[model samples]
Target: MTASTHWLATAAAQSVLERGGNAFDAAVAGGFVLHIVEPHLNGPGGDMVALISPGGVDPSVLMGQGPAPAGASIDHFRAEGLQSVPGAGALAAAVPGAVDAWLMLLEDHGTWELTDVLEYALHYAETGHALGAQAAAVIGTMGQHFSEHWHSSAAQWMPNGQIPHEGDMIKNPPYAEVLRRLIAAGFDGGTRQRRIRLAREEWKSGFVAQSAVAFARTSHRHSSGSDHRGVLDMGDFANFSASYEEPQSINFRGTTIVKAGFWSQGPVLLQALAILDHFDDEHLDPSTAPGAHTILETLKLAMADRDAYYGDSASPRALRQLLEPEYAHGRAAEIEPTASREFRPGRIPGLKPFFPILTADPGESSVLGAGEPTVKISGETRGDTCHIDVVDRHGNMVSATPSGGWLQSSPTIPPLGFALGTRLQMTWLDPDSPSALRPGTRPRTTLSPTLLMKDGFATAALGTPGGDQQDQWQLLYLLRTIVGGYNPQQAIDAPMFHTSALAGSFWPREFHPAGVVMENRVSPDVLADLRDRGHEISIVDGWSLGRLSTVIRDPASGSMGAAANPRGNQGYAGGR
Candidate 1:
């Protein structure tokens, strides 16, 4: 069974499963197709993180997130006349890790050959695939910038100087050729594993690295309205590789919730769950005013700590203390019927918290279109990210969020047929900050995927692609499934809400004190009640907020099910 943000990608995963491949192989195949179909959301030159549970083994995180380049330092960015990293440009790129990471997973846990997986992606990239409406619209919005500033991007996306209309046949022969070359490089190997390893080396030390490094040396227009050369080099790409890590999880109710470590925002979900666990079941139902208020308030507190403490730093015992039951009870007790508008991070007994200067009014301080890529020309709307969740018949499961490196985020590398990701913009400039920009440090990324288990068996795999709202949306789905007794589809169909009370992870770091954006699916009376409780409310269209997808396995019956968000027309889920 497979659930993903794109129907084509989901079909690809289903096809892989029918071909006797495990969940890992199906996920890798689906992920590659996602890069082609969801170009506006993800691409080949991006990064991804996955949670994989092989049958009869402990689940682990496939850490595909790349770190800052060896030369990417705060001093260098400041010297470039920048207060923060640009949202879209070569200067904001980190080492591309998605390709290597996907290949690593296939070699280690998958049964298919490298060529078998590449075949699906190759067919779509070489032959023409129908252009997605959202992708086309995004390209149309950035048409002017591409034509004037990024000629390489113009040549690829806007052929003949015109953006392709939706449903038009869009082909990426150049990207196909790149994949073919990598496949060819692996043919002269001893074993399947060796061949995959050869492909990885070629990606790091061969033409891929050379082209990326050469392109970074040239000046390009950035979100700051200035041109700057990138800090990346061949050595940076060569030195980086994806590896497996133990997942951090906590037992909630009877189910265990697993997520990536502090490097990503995955842990924030766990922290929020800990706080909400103290509330009664009635107060946790998202459909009601009290339920929504309690969840939103808890999210704000967890997000405050996220901004203050979560990162890739070593020996941070503060995280352990924050997740303690005693601490969670104390934090939950602070919530009142009225909303709290202040940015309050919990202080651990022996640890001093680092708080950056907060923007009182984000509207006045934010630069227009300065952070992550947005779909609309105005840049007010958040851009979409890609997610894939698969559970095979063998009970193996995987959930991955593959994002960053959208074509609109940077000038397309002519040879590679894609752009470098601007994920480095997530890092802060302050030395004391946990997510401070430093050479060889992983950025505190917002791309988070989730896995749930029960009695040592994988129960569910779920995730979405809404920058800071990823885990927030997932939290609602989980509460509905675990507490409210809703099925996967029912849980996803329910109204979703998220708070902007804490600083955003993207550039220009926007925040709104006690602000909440909820779908109008909630009752008018509930909305009025929330407003009366001092929560600032902004009502959006009924299905405009979350894009969550999930695949679940019934431990007792051994039956599997999958469901995707109906909010956007693109997401799909199918299995038998």
Candidate 2:
């Protein structure tokens, strides 16, 4: 996908595939290089979740999300009353498992050497990659996040320790040095003993393509980009490792299926799907006028289950009923067919009720009038995307996503040029139900790399990184494109919207429409109607105009197609 927040990043990912590396190899290089080239979004310390479709087998998934440090404890926060961890505190950090996860996938599923897999990242770090409009914009706005975290993050990002203007060459030799060392430990073909003859090998056999490298290198020289040298070291590389596991899958109505592997939110998809499957599709056609009503019904049910009952296995919630079809059927029956229900508290059979009165207020007040609604440009969102989907000449398909290490609490130990992700932000310290922060537990995450199966075979591989928004985006696109008969481009290009019980709620799910911004593209009357209903609302430019990068491959053509939402600077869709 070219419109990737960083085209240079996409160019690098594509280069990996062209060099004969598979999607796994390409995704690894892309994540690394993006960290070097687009530090504002994400870096090495970030986590990743992948959904891959191996030949005849169901799609297997991977979770490299880091866990709380062995010593992190709830008692600590309770005594301190720390509701939220700061961006730089040790308490906010986790044992980064992203790198180890990548290595594990490679060792288990990748056929190429580590050197071949991470070639693009190696080059971009040793040299430098260029910046783009989208990448620049996201950093410009979030500069405060960097300043609050590490000096390395700021010194390299801030111009003379200040924010750089657009087009500035944000360089970081210190960060670059980190990438150089990593390459030296692996990439450079500085073999001590080379025979007079080069081994006769095609790119498919695992050779870094000269053409791809030069293309990416040339792209780096002319553009404006960041200098985030990765933080891996010789010792870290030697110590990094991985393993394999069977994946989990669940079938949904109308050719829908969701899969996850050991230690991920994948299983949640199955639970939600089973829950939705309980609904009668006869009245919920999404493309029709009734779709909106159905969507709200399904999302509310899914989110409620997600909020109160969902948690890491280490917690004390009973999920057996959540995944049971009978429970879903009973829950769906609770919805009043004629009217949208107000946000309220509900119990799962025997569970206690939680009345989450809607409680959020207006956000980002730089306003408009009854006549002229001023729209604020969406700054580059942090560590969002860069994914690759491949169905090899062998018909084995793979889909992988690499994320930016979050800035809030991600710390970089200078010499490594990389940062540790403060993934704790994904979890709530004071969760009223389950999925709350606990000692050594992974949070309920948004990165669910998915492989959609239809007609008993893989039809598409898709996923994105937009926190909780990731689910609605992926779900809507898949439902529209694959199920509703829309093409990939049309599916993503179509207007979109999400019902956030949190952002709009008075406190968290305060049913205030003013705090909830929908796109102006919607029918104005529909907007007015929702506002009249006490569903707080505001209007954002693209709340429903399109989607992030989502790629689909039709086995019939042996070709891949991608559609990127143009609202954001770097959304792209293309194939080799």
Estimate TM-scores for all models.
0.97, 0.77
Leading candidate by TM-score: 1
Candidate 2, 270-318: lDDT as tens digits: 6555655665654344444345445555566665555555556422334
Give model 2 RMSD, 1 decimal.
Answer: 9.2
- Give candidate 1 misplaced runs (Cα > 4 Å): 314-316, 363-370, 374-380
For candidate 1, give the lDDT of residue 296. Answer: 93
Query: RMSD per prediction, one decimal?
Result: 1.8, 9.2
Please report, in order, the local distance difference test score of every candidate based on alpha carbons.
Answer: 0.87, 0.50
Clashing pairs in 1: none
Q: How many Å off is the CA of 571 in candidate 2?
A: 1.9
- Would you give me the overall lDDT of model 2? 0.50
Q: Model 1: C-alpha RMSD to truth?
A: 1.8
